[model samples]
Target: MTRNSLAARALPPAVLVQIPATSKANAHIDPGSGSFFVQMSLVGLLYAGVAIKPYWRRTKAFLTGRRSTPEADDESSDS
Candidate 1:
């Protein structure tokens, strides 16, 4: 369509929309959730530790500044 025809059929300016304040939510916020979050985080950490347990010896060695790899440990144990 032509620009002039489009301009003639243009809609009126929109009103500024604003949300009206309403009463507070009636939902119950659990006060006991702080402990639950702490417990869940601890459990997650424990689970992570357990999941990586096969690599625990290398992990500990690496943290203690050891440069040896798991293969080296296995070779030494075979001697």
Candidate 2:
């Protein structure tokens, strides 16, 4: 095709449209959750203590020259 024919088929100029403003009823601002976050952190610390309790017991036993007895050792199970 010729340049003249290509120029004739070019796209039209873009038209600008006005945007509508948002209404107050559609907008909502949330109050942040502070207590829930504190509770979560406390729960995390509790979980960590629970998870480390066995290792702490083993370390204490080793330091005190006492054997972590099978009866007291919850980390292992033997038949």
Candidate 3:
């Protein structure tokens, strides 16, 4: 008769109904496995690009004589 007991009695059923498998479905295309590989490759490429971006920028700046820091080589004639 308590609120807690009434709440406990309002629980839904736990049995889950599943759809039966079909025989005519294509067995060659495993979408889950393909999607997993694709996701992993994309994540790897994303991390690689992120890891190399700073190095690429620094190399580019150094090669082009573009000082990246405040105490870097002075290019102006303000002696």
lDDT of 1 by residue, 1-79 (tens): 2342233224221211123538865769764778756765654444344334436657777889877564543331111
Tens digit per residue, CA lDDT, model 2, 6-33: 2322322111112343764443765347
TM-score of each model, in listed order: 0.31, 0.42, 0.42
Cα-based lDDT for every prediction: 0.45, 0.47, 0.45
* Model 1's TM-score against the true structure: 0.31
TM-score of 3: 0.42
Residue 16 CA displacement from its true place in model 3, Å: 33
Worst 10 residues of 3 by lDDT: 70-79
Residue-level lDDT of model 3, residues 1-79, one tens digit each, is: 2343233234322211123546766668766978866765654444444444445656868899985653231222112
Global CA lDDT computed for model 3: 0.45
For candidate 2, the 10 contiguous residues with the lowest summed lDDT are 9-18
Clashing residue pairs, candidate 1?
none
List residue ranges in candidate 1 displaced over 4 A: 1-31, 58-79
- Model 3 regions lying over 4 Å from their true place: 1-32, 69-79
